[model samples]
Target: MQNEKIINYIKNWLDNYLVKTNLNGFVVGVSGGIDSAVTSTLCAMTKQKVLCVEMPIHQDISQVTRAQQHIAWLKSNYNNVSSVEVDLTPTFDAFKQGLPKTNSKREDLALGNSRARLRMTTLYYLAGLHNYLVVGTGNKVEDFGVGFYTKYGDGGVDLSPIADLMKSEVYSLAQTLNIIDVIQNAEPTDGLFGDSRSDEDQLGASYDELEWAMQYEGNPEELSSRQAEVLKIYKSLNSANQHKMKPIPICSIPSEFK
Candidate 1:
């Protein structure tokens, strides 16, 4: 891809969207990941008011450090960029405490998703406070290929600037944007579970394999065992998570009944 052309295009798109919506600016949740780094840089390039909020809920120290470093770099480079760190650890703890005890095996997964929802709530709160749009950091693989993000959580946003870019494309933009090495080099993780589990660990496949599967429309018989396994993983996730990829379902009432 022509990196410079894509970068300029996104910046101009953001500027025009802001004018059309008449919103003050954008508020992005920086997560010490490539997608967020590239996205925040693009927003900053627009020279618009961009608020980078870091909401950590018992997050790994490395992730938090990278997030702070990226935000610091952004401020130094762009005068329009600003940042805030909201420690949601206490809030998350209290929320869990208030909830009833559960023996379901899905409890851990549910709480992991809750962390993302809490951050989403925090981002929207900031956006509302400043009349800014909540900018999403999801990429093509996560947003469309496998639906890896949390629905109504990190998935909740006013606009997604990088959703069309693949993970590799996101990295290309990160390098051009001069994102901090620590972030660009760090393993991709959602940081929702307060642990060091990487995205690949959770997804059962690396982003490169998933990306290939997303675009693959070939004879399955020619594939190796590993490749076939990856394809199955990709297809299973794509089928199961269609709920996230599609618009919300609404039951239509019959006009005659009304």
Candidate 2:
């Protein structure tokens, strides 16, 4: 789809959702990545009240800077756009200190997931206060195919405007929206871990490879070795993270019990 049409569709969807739910506005966590940048921009485009918050939890300065720049750009372009910075470093530190010790990698992974859940909690708190919906920034590959988001964390949201778009498509929309150069050029990171790990670093595959794998048919004989390797990585990730992508399982009681 054309960028303009995509923007209109998302803006209309947000408008319809607010009207349907009787919500006042949207509360989006701007993580200084293209996904968040694009999502926030779309929310701002609706001309509805958009609270674009920067929640940094011991985050890198560059990430914060990029988020601030995007917010500034939004404020300049949209009258309804407002921003606030909430540092969750102290909160995260307290939570980390309370956790039981484990292996470094395992602990780091746990802490990173906790940070996402913490941000989700923060967003819900603000959303409740303002009577706004929590807008998510997850894209198709991360949200569905690979389930890269933290369960009940970034995965917890009232609406996801760009959940249907691929990562490459998000970059395309970001370009069309004239997103800030800093954010557009910034590497995609969850900003939930120390040293600022990129999504590719964590996923073991680039977005492009993941996207290809998501669409590619599994025919080992027809694929190059490198392609097969990417597909293997994609399948492993999808299998491991399937729980996050699927709905919660519930046991159904027999009707005779009634």
RMSD of each: 0.7, 1.2
Clashes of each: 0, 0
- The worst-scoring run of ten residues by lDDT in candidate 1 lies at 171-180
Clashing pairs in 1: none
| Model 1, TM vs. native | 0.99
What are the lDDT figures for the candidates, one per model? 0.95, 0.92
Per-residue lDDT of model 2, residues 1-258, tens digit only: 598998999999999999899989999999889999999999998899999988898889999989988899899999999988888999999988887777776777888899999999999999999999999999999998899999999999998999999999999999999998888888899888857789899888999999999999757789998899899999999999999988899999999997
By how many angstroms RMSD does model 2 differ from the true structure? 1.2
Task: State in Å the error of residue 109, model 1.
Answer: 0.7
lDDT of 1 by residue, 108-210 (tens): 9999999999999999999999999999999999999999999999999988989999999999988888899999899999998989999999999999999
Q: In model 2, state the lDDT of residue 74.
A: 93
Q: Distance from true position, residue 234, model 2, in Å?
A: 0.6
Candidate 2 ranges with C-alpha deviation above 4 Å? none
Per-residue lDDT of 115 in model 1: 95
